[model samples]
Target chain A: MFEWNAYLIIIAAVAGLFFATAVAALVWAVKNGQFSNLEQGARSIFDAEEPEGIQQDFFPGEADEQRAKLEKERRPS
Target chain B: MSPLLSFFSSIDPKARPGIPVKVQLSEIDESMRTPSILFLSAAVCWLVIGSFFALVASIKLHSPDFLANVEWLTFGRARSAHLNAMAFGWANNAIFAVSLWIMARLCKTAVRHGGLLIIAGIFWNIGVTIGVIGILTGGLTSVEWLEMPPQVAPILAFSYILIGVWGVIAFRFRQLGHVYVSQWYILAALFWFPWLYIIAQTMIFIEPARGTVQAITNWWFAHNVLGLWFTPVGLGAIYYFLPKVLGRPIYSYYLSVLGFWSLALFYNWAGVHHLIGGPIPVWLISAGIVASVMMVIPVIVTAINHHFTAVGNARATWASPTLRFIVFGAMSYTLASLFGSGMALRDVNVVTHFTQFTVGHAHHGVYAFFTMVMYGSIYFMMPRMLNREWPSAALIKTHFWCCAIGIGIMLVGLHVGGWIQGMMMNELTPDGNPKYTFLEVVHALVPWLFSRSVSGVLLTIGHIAFFVHFFWMLAGPKISRYREGPTLLLDSIRGEGKAG
Candidate 1:
């Protein structure tokens, strides 16, 4: 029975260590300004830009036609 | 402007007006192409192999005499093979592919050692192969979830180290300033798995813990395999894909933080529930019960976050193969977790313990929740990796319906039948005799076992369809070319917007 209780102490120590590590990570994240811009964090994956000199249109297929229509709509005449 | 500079600019709050969305998502595709395909292909092969083993095991449960003469085909060996194949062979491989790609993309860094990843993946599969064969050949350890022979463990561990460290290295060189919630999950899972595996192996196999303590260690390791490893990776994929597909942010960032931290803290302690009604002390069981119940906070928080994000985009979600599987999985995660908490209660545990109810609950978590989410991630990742759309939307639809129906029938049959079996076992006649004989209980499960076999057959059909469809997409010259855009469920909806 004491052996089992000894195992419990190991469990407690591991649990305590895990809790400390988690708290430290959380503090580090907070201090590093990781949580400051939640909105920007969400949009970060979409930050990849279309390669330069390629069709600037984000939509696939009919890119040239779409560019022409945009240019015509923006003309001063 | 260069994509790298634009990436940094986009993260800066003040420079938003000048920031251009010029980063070709294809760059991510190019970087991850070779490794992702290699891992996914291996995972699909294992899915088919594992499904066959599962059908064999399910059949033996109801019909004991079938294939009994073959030494290698015994129920014990076959079942162990099936479990290891699915867990290590299919699930782990899929996780490596999907999570690594997600990590690279989110970090804005190309996977540096593509050739090394492929080599590690090949070794991982080889290790699983040798381990399964060892179990069949009478080298089995008989430990639940660790049945893979001792000889194979080192190889698996070494290969896993290679792959796991790759993810951290990618993160170390990440271009992004802010780490997303999904990255935190993936990173934690990568780190946690090796620690859990090594410690469990040391205590149970290496040092040999004292009698019941071996059982304690077993439960701890088994439960953490599901909770710490599979659960985190699945949730991380959900956190990434759901928002990406929906073109929106999660409902509440604060809730996500709470969900991640609470799960990390509570789940590790909850595995002792498996020891209930056994020789372990009452305090351990009580602690497990409390922690299991505490799981409600994270489960509900994740459920709400996923629900509110997808609720408004019902049409788009249904129309995308990726979102449909993911949403199904996200919902199953909520249901399975709630049921698991309920099962930990003594009153419920009394009836559910040592019954098919536990088996059904296991599938509900591992298959319906974890495997389905992995399937969704595969659908999302493959197209990007291969630069080609799925060959046939019909095959995708067929795969989904078959698995959904198969697991549904299996769960209902097992739970209802098992509950009755448990109740019957607990019944006592006058003078303290079991109301039913042992054979009678076994006899009663026959029909439920048969239903499980049928469900296995259906699942097998789904696996074959998925494998063939994937192969056709990969090898067929006509469909292998890079498609200009993604394949959506409905042609009418294609090119409409980025809603997919």
Candidate 2:
């Protein structure tokens, strides 16, 4: 007789659907270019403070030397 | 991986954009310095405490009477205490530190209200302290993941909101740029965790959902805490640190989008796999099983993205202590999650359910995957925040090896042993009786259980070494300049990173 609870399942489905719908509505409302310029967000975490080519956490006496060396190596001879 | 792709590895990164001068990195670091240190200190302290509790509980498995006389040290109380202490005390505190720091950095904003954030952190730790104490003193609610007494709920809830609100604030005021994938994860996690926490507290205890609904809700909450909560933050850290440390971008932007949304969609429904054999609806269990299997998509996407990104950067990954731990954690994430999907299969779950196998899986995911990522983030963040290299490279190496080996041993002992235990327990005698007695099962698990204790001791030793190194650096006076190079794992690999 006590095999399973159908009511509980229905409640769960309803709650999930409600949240999904709410999220969809929120996404529709915010047309603020949230997903635009995809690459910019990818690279935005980089700053001039520690530029991409220069590994900030690297070893060596001077960070500038590491960058200079890398630039020189990658330069087209 | 790189030797085959050696030609592509040296492709000119000169095509990449010069760093924009939008945000001051140092200013961001300065703003978060005090709070990050505070949270990390608390996390390490809890790591030690949790280690103690874990050792006690593991010992009880092999030698129950070892602490039989001590009331607070009984198996139930000790296990519960360890879970709460590690989950709330250690893991959450580490998340607060690294996740917030990463969010602020990605948002390109200095945290505006540092004082309030610190206060919220204090309250969060205080709440966890009280809750752990409650569990030890017999106030456990006996729910699987929500074992802390009912009274500790509000304190945790309030503080969690206060801390989480800062991530939202940072995102709200984020610089006008493309929002990075890490931001998506941190933001989702910040919101998803609190909703799960509050709903769990209410449904499971406060206003009891009758019968198996409570049990279902409990598993749903418990499972998703790892799925929705820890997994997102861990993956986000990998996304952030892997690229940053390797000096590259992720392999594909589309893959990131695929990984994030698929995880969100599938992981929510996957929690019911925890209740497979229990008296839940079969349809519900089936839905959960499908979702768990579907998790393979995001897992594969993440693995490909990270693996390609790290291909040419193997030397760089090795040179930096941060990436060493991170690479290990990222690999663990892929392994454990895939194993988890398999474990959720009905056939597998039948054998593994209520066995030590499930316990082994928990550590595989939480310790091997999540905790190690947090440790890497700390390695990355601490030096930047303090503006000084770690005090001792030797100690850092010690920490890494100890933790790596310890968890490795743990994964093997528990999984292999648990599988054998499950098989033996499920075996039936020829005359239609259970073959293995409960006592026989116990006797069989002794060696594996002893290995777990041994692993715990190793982990505790690592924690002490880490504790000493971290506090030493935190307490030491800041060096005025970088006259001496940042500490390196090996000066032998001269041209790779240690150019000087």
Candidate 3:
């Protein structure tokens, strides 16, 4: 019966350790500026911007002439 | 056009040409082609195999004498095999393929160690095979989720370590300055799963905790397998594909952060609810119930984030196969989770515990929510990986409807029948005697079990269609001039800026 108490203590200690680790992680994240730029983080998925002046390949079935025409219409005079 | 009309039209983003994200995504998909294909194909094979086992098990429930003589096909071994196959073989493998691809793309890094990933995947499947076979051959451990014998656990763990480390390595070499919320969830899951698995194995099997503590450890591990392991990966995929398919970001970054952290903190503790009526202390059960209720914060926050993001985009969501299935899964996640919290209450748990209601809830979480989202992710992924449009929209529609309807019937039949069974089991006569015999209650469940078998057949059809269509796309030629863009359910939605 006393062994039950020992097992309980061990479980409690493990739970405490998990709680402390989580708090530590939260603190480290805050300290390291992980939460500073929320909007930028949201936008980060689209960070793969191709360089200007590179001729991008047209999607399948899209004519090159049509793409060039669209590009010309977008360019300033 | 009139000035007023032009003003309103200019404010609508959907009226504009779609963003040029697909080209960039294709590059990432190209880099991950080999490993992602291997994982996906293996996962589909397991899905088919698991569905077979599931059907057999469901049949035996209604007709016990059908295959009673076959040692390997007995209820105990077959059911355990089905659970492990679906959980580890199918779910883990699909997560490896989809989540790793998402991690690589979100980090802006081409997968560096593709060969290592394939090798790890092969070994992981091998381990699961050995484990399943061991269970059939009289080596069953009787542990709920850890039914895989001890001899195979080490190999499984080692293979998982190899696969999991690759995600961390990819993040270490990431090119982005800002880590997306999806990355945090995926990365955390990759770390948490092995820790939970190892600790549970040590306590339950190796050191062998005394008496009811073993039951405590078992429930803790089993529930965490669903909560920590499967839930995070499923949510990560939802966070990624939801935004990408809608061509927008998640509605509120603050809400996402709250949802992620609250889930991480509360879910691990809620596992104790499975032991609510057991021999454990009352305070422990109360803690589990509290944490289970606290889960509402994350569930509601995530539901709102996903819901608001899809608002006004119903047309596109309905038109795209990926978004359609994912939205179904997202809604299921919210409903199933809230229902789960309610089930954890002592009053409700009294009737639901040790009944088929719990089984219905488990399927709701694992199948309707997690597996549906995975199917959606695969639909989006296969096109990008193969650089071709799906050969048949009819097949995709067939797969979706079959699974949706099948799981729907199963959940309804199980819950309604289980409730009757539970209530009857709890009833007593005025003279302090039982109202119904145990066998009588068992006899009542036969009809519901038969309905479950019918649902199983529908799901099997869905699985076959999915696998056939997937392989057809793989072996077919790339997209040509005639079959140009990504396939959409609606013709008008084609060539729009939707990610496959």
Candidate 4:
């Protein structure tokens, strides 16, 4: 029978393990350049230019271009 | 519109396929700036209301006679007013202003016809003003947090729908790409708040749920409002601010994804933890406790990611007002979440519940963690909106110190006071009756109360200073200034600030 005390301890241990793995993965991501540009990521959608060497593959068709034109016309002069 | 087309458009454009991305003011393309200005003004008024109510409530704790026992300004009404004004009025309005900016930037679209949003802002202000008046007039519904009376509640809810419709429309017209973390939080908060608010109001106010169910439901509603609504917005801010201030990318996208999913799944059941040891069923409480402790996983993950993101960039703590508030908020989040989980333990709650400890916990989350993060967001945002930097770094420094010290002192006083109160309550007399006199507990808290008031004064001063700076910034005096390099002391000269 798993007593409440034992269950709690086990759960806590599992939580600790999960936390460790998460931290390790985070550090790995940081090294891999996940957080290199904060403002750029948030603003990328609005700006037309791309970061050099980074290729964006979204919006591959004419409708996308049409929407872009509509958005452009709405911009403040 | 075809169903498929409608669905595609309905999906937030921020989720559309990739485009070239860069961080610049130009990226924040919006059709109208008026809604943002209106929301900002609302935020300032709400800040005053929230802090003033907080002072009233805090003062009442020590001397119930401080205000001559005014019926309308009773502790019950004042406390609820303080929290609701802060959460709904101040925090939500600020979120509206910032989210509009972020959504437009992320979606790669102008806030298509945001003129409607300005009207929505006007409606929101009216609703909040009426609601606060209702609370002060003893029109409270007797529920914690959701205390607005029926007459005021409908107005508030209606206003929310108008604003929410804008958010939905904005999401639908967004440029396509993978949904970003901030988008997830904003949209989820928008959706979850109405669902929770409306359902709870209907069930509690209209239908009148059965005994104990109401209590359970009240706790459920209160906790979720914090978790589902405020927490998402706060985290969304952290997601934005950490990278922006530090000039880095989030450390781990995969980890963030996991953190989000785990949080959504684990956070809902956490409301039950507040009911621990209440008349609620043991199983329900146990489930809540489990979820509370399990929250450690998400909190730790967020903490680690945020902390490391600013490791080498810690110098920015002094340079950037936004970074200072945000970093402080991020640290507080770790402590509050951990503290919450600890309090979920039966041993801790048995003593700490129904004491100043609960008050401490509430402020720790709402003010120290949630409000601080929002402050950071506002600081980061205002310059962009006003097209001018803050006029006085001195005022910002003063505000930061006052708030930081004020909250620190208040939390410490409350925690110690509550522990003593809890211990006294647990004592038993030889006759098997309660041994501790209620007066004894009350008397013990006197010093703590005085300390709390002192801290309240500090926080109030900070808020007033912030208001003055904000007002001056808005008026556009065109003050000639240069950055005073980061110095250990205000008077001392140091090197240049990083961003400056």
| TM-score of each predicted structure versus truth | 0.88, 0.89, 0.88, 0.80
TM-score of 3: 0.88
lDDT of 2 at B271: 85
Which is the winner by DockQ between candidate 2 and candidate 3? 2
Residue B111, model 2: Cα distance from true site in angstroms = 0.9
lDDT of 4 by residue, B44-89 (tens): 7899878898889888888888785688788888888887788789
- Pick the winner on DockQ between candidates 1 and 2: 2
Question: Model 2, range B94-134, lDDT digits (tens) per residue?
Answer: 99999999998887767765888899999999999998999
For all candidates in order, the CA lDDT equals: 0.81, 0.81, 0.81, 0.71
The deviation in Å at residue B316 for candidate 3 is 0.7
Chain A TM-score of each candidate structure, as shown: 0.56, 0.47, 0.57, 0.48
Docking class of 1: incorrect
What local lDDT score does residue B93 receive in model 3, on the 0 to 100 scale? 93
Residue runs of model 1 more than 4 Å from their true location after superposition: A1-5, A48-77, B1-24, B478-484, B487-500
Model 2, span A5-76: residue lDDT tens: 653864487449636943663474247575566666566666555545445454323334544555555565
True contacts kept of 4: 0.01
Looking at model 2, the pairs that clash are A41-B178
Q: List the residue pairs that clash in candidate 1.
A: A48-B23, A49-B22, A49-B23, A49-B24, A50-B22, A50-B23
What's the residue-level lDDT of B37 in candidate 2?
A: 94
- Number of residue pairs clashing in candidate 3, backbone atoms closer than 3 angstroms, sequence gap of 3 or more or interchain: 0
